[model samples]
Target: MHHISNPSILYFGTPVVLVGTTNSDQTYNLAPISSAFWLGYRCMIGIAAHSKTTENILRSGECVLNLPSVDQVEAVDRLALLTGTSPVPAGKLAKGYSYEADKFKKAGVTPLESNLVKAPRVLECPVHLEARFVSIHPLGAETGIDQIRSVALELKVVRVHLAGSILSDANPDHVDPNKWKPLIMSFQHFYGLGSQLQPAKLASVPERLYRTFDTESAKATH
Candidate 1:
C-alpha cells in the first residue's frame, strides 16, 4: 500500500555530522548538518546559502566533520534550532530559529584542536575527519525558489581521528560495526539502528564469520 503525496522536507534518514568551521574573528563555529556523504577520501556536504557554516568554509577552505553516535542525540537536537548568523534571517526566524553565538557551549560539546585544520573537532563525537575544502557548486534552482537553494561543497579528507572503542584492535583499517551506533535523522526525527534481520546476499563475508565478529564487537562494547 503506497500513496504518492508531496512532502515538505526530503530528509529521510541520514547520519548527522557536526561541521566545524572557522569564524571571521578566528573563532570556531560548529553547526549540525545531515546533508553529507563520502566516497573514498572525498566528501560532499550540502549547506544552505544563508548559513554561516557555508560562509566560513568558503572563506577558510577547511572544516572538520564530526560523526556523533546515537547516545549524543540529545546534544545534536539541542543545536537544531540554533543558527550561527547573529541577526537571524527572517525565514529562519519564522521556523523558530534563533541566533546562537557560542554553539559549542550551548550544545554542551567540548572542542578539540585539530592538527591539520583550523576548525576544531567535537570531543564528544567518536569519529572526526579533518578536511580541506576544494570547491562549491550551486544546486536546487529548478524549484524556482531562492530559499531552497543550497551549495554543495567538495572536501578532501586530510586526517581521520577515531575513538579506540569504535575501532577494531585486530585490524586497524576496519571499524567494528557493532560497536558504532550512528544517530540517524528520519524526517526530522532521531533514530538508532535496529537489530540485524538477515544477512545480505551480496555481502562478501561468510555468514559464520560475520556473526563471530558481530558478537565479539558487541561483547567488547558492553
Candidate 2:
C-alpha cells in the first residue's frame, strides 16, 4: 500500500447551508454555501467576496440560514448552479426564475416571512435560524482568483426554529436524536447520515462499565 499527504488542501467536512438575503432593490436571493456553523448560541458564516450573497449581506446586514433535509437535496443543488449575478433565461420573472429575483419558486422551495429579519426562510428546511449581522472580515483570494476572496461574518442568533416532528411533547428540550437528521458533505459528495450513538451513562453497574472501558478490544470491535 502507498499513501500520500498534503497539508495545504481544503478538507473541511461540513454541512451545506443556504443563505437567504435580500438585494438592495428588495428582491430575494438564495446562496448555497458550506462555510457556516454555530458557536454557542452565535452563528458565524464565512463567505467570499465578489459573491452576490456577500454584496447583498453587506448592504442589508440581515439574512436567514436555512438547513434543508435530504428530501430537498436535489432542489437545493439546483440553486447552487444558478447565480443571481447571471442573467435570467428569456422571460420567466412572473413564474419566479429571474436571475436577480427570488429563485425559491424555481427551486421548488417555499418561503415564509421572518419574525425579525427582512429575509425569508425556506419552509422546507427543518431548521431555520434568524440572524443579525455582527461583523465581516475580508481575506484575499486563495489562488489568485479575482472573484474568490474570503469574507468571514459573525452573526447573533435571534431565534431558532426547528421542525415540530423533531421534538417530543413528552420532552421538548430533549430533541429526538433519531429525528435530528443532517446531510453531511465530504469531498464534494453528499450523504444522508449515520446512526446516533448513545451517550455514556452513570446508571450502568460499575463492573460492567469498567470492563467496557478497560478493554482495548471493545474500541476495536465497535
Candidate 3:
C-alpha cells in the first residue's frame, strides 16, 4: 500500500558525525551532525546555514569528521541541544538550543590533535577523517532564490584514523562491518546498526578498484 505523504523532515537513518572545527578564537568546536554521506574519499555534510561549525569550516578550510560508535551515544546526546554560536541563533534557540562555550566539555569528550588539520579529533570516537573543504552547495532555496536554510559542504578526506578494534583482523586497512557499530540517527532518535541481513551483489566488485584521485592525493599529502 503506497500513498503520497509529506513529512515535516526527511531524516532517514544516517550515521552520526561529530564535526570538529577551529573557532575564530583558535578554540575547538565540535558539533554532532547526522546529515552526511560519502562517495569515494569525498564526503558531503549538511548543516545549518548559519551554524558556528559552518562558519568555522569556511574560515579554517578544514575539519575533522569524528565517527562515534554506538557506545558513545550518551556523549553524543549531551551535545544535541548545544550550539557553539554565542547568544544562540533565533532558529536554534526556538528549538531549545543554547550557547555552549565549550562543546567538547559539554559532550564529555576529549579532543586530540589532528595530524593534518587544525581542528582536533574527538578522542572518544572510533574513526576520524581529516578533511579539507572543497566547496559548498546551498539547500532549501528556489531558482528565484531569496533564503537559504541550510548548506551541503563537500570535503576531501586527507587522512583517516581508525580504532584497531573496528578494523578487520585479516585486513587491518579495512573496517569490519560486523565489528563497527555506528551511531545512527533516524527521525530524531538514535539507533545502532543491526546484524547484516545478507551479502550484497556489489560485494563482487573489488573495493580497491573503486579507489579514486582522492585516495592517491591522501597518500601524497602530509
Candidate 4:
C-alpha cells in the first residue's frame, strides 16, 4: 500500500541552474533555478512573474543554464532563498551571497566566455547550456498571482564542457551520468542524487565512478 502525500506543493529532484540573463539596462541578472530540463539538446526553463530572467529573455531572447554540483549546493540554495527584488543593499541567498553586480564574486563561481550567448558560463559547473527563448506559457497558481506555466527554450547545442576528471578520452563511453550532481527539489525539500545504476550506450562509465552522481540519478528519469 502507498500513502498519499500532500499535493499543496511538491518538490522533487530538480537540477539547480544559474539562469544568466541581461536586463534592459544591459545589466546581468543571475537567478538560480531547479525548474530546468533538456530534450535531446533543447532546454526549457520555468520562471515566475515579472522576474528579471523573464524580462531579460523577453528583451534579449537569450540565456544560459549553468549546472551546479554538490560542493556548490549551499550556494545554489542561497540563490533560491534570497529574492532579487528585495530592498536590502546586499543580502545572503543560501550558500551564496548577493550583490548588485557581483553575484559571481559572492558565490565564488567562475565566469567563462560563451560562443553564442551574451551571458557567460559558470566554470565550476560540469555542464553549460546556451539557449534561446522559443515559447512561453502562463500558469495560474492557487495562491500566488500567477506562476509560469512553462517556458520552452529551444537551443542548438553550441558547446558542452566537462571536468577533466569526469572526461575520459580513451574510453569515449567513459562519460558517467553520476558525475554531474545536481540539486533537485521535491515537496519543498532538497535531495541529492544517489547514483548511476546503469550505463547507457552514449557512455559506458561504470556505475561506481562517481559517488554523488549515483546518489542523485539512482532512480531519475534522465
Top model by lDDT, which number? 3
Q: Which is the leading candidate under TM-score?
A: 3
Taking the candidates one at a time, how many backbone clashes does each contain? Answer: 0, 0, 0, 23
Candidates' C-alpha lDDT: 0.86, 0.72, 0.93, 0.63
Candidate 2, residues 1-222, lDDT tens digits: the string is 877867564746777788888877787888777777876446778875667788887888888888877777887777855667665434334436536355887788888888778987899888888777888766665556565567888877666677897776776534565787766666666777778567657535543334332232212221
Residue pairs with colliding backbones in model 1 are none
Model 2 misplacement above 4 A: 6-9, 86-100, 140-148, 198-222
Q: Score every model by TM-score.
A: 0.87, 0.75, 0.96, 0.70
Q: How well does model 2 score by local distance difference test? A: 0.72
- Candidate 1 lDDT over 1-222, as tens digits, reads 999989999998889999999999988789999988986667899888779999999889999999999989999999998998989999899999998989999999999998778999999999998888898877876766664668899998777788998987787656778789998888989899987678767677643454333233323221
Which has the higher lDDT value, candidate number 1 or candidate number 4? Answer: 1
lDDT of 3 by residue, 74-111 (tens): 99999998999988889888999999889898889999
Pairs with backbone N, CA or C atoms under 3 Å apart (clashes), candidate 3:
none
Off by over 4 Å in 1: 142-148, 201-222
For every candidate in turn, the CA RMSD to the true structure comes to 6.7, 10.9, 1.4, 8.5
TM-score of 2: 0.75
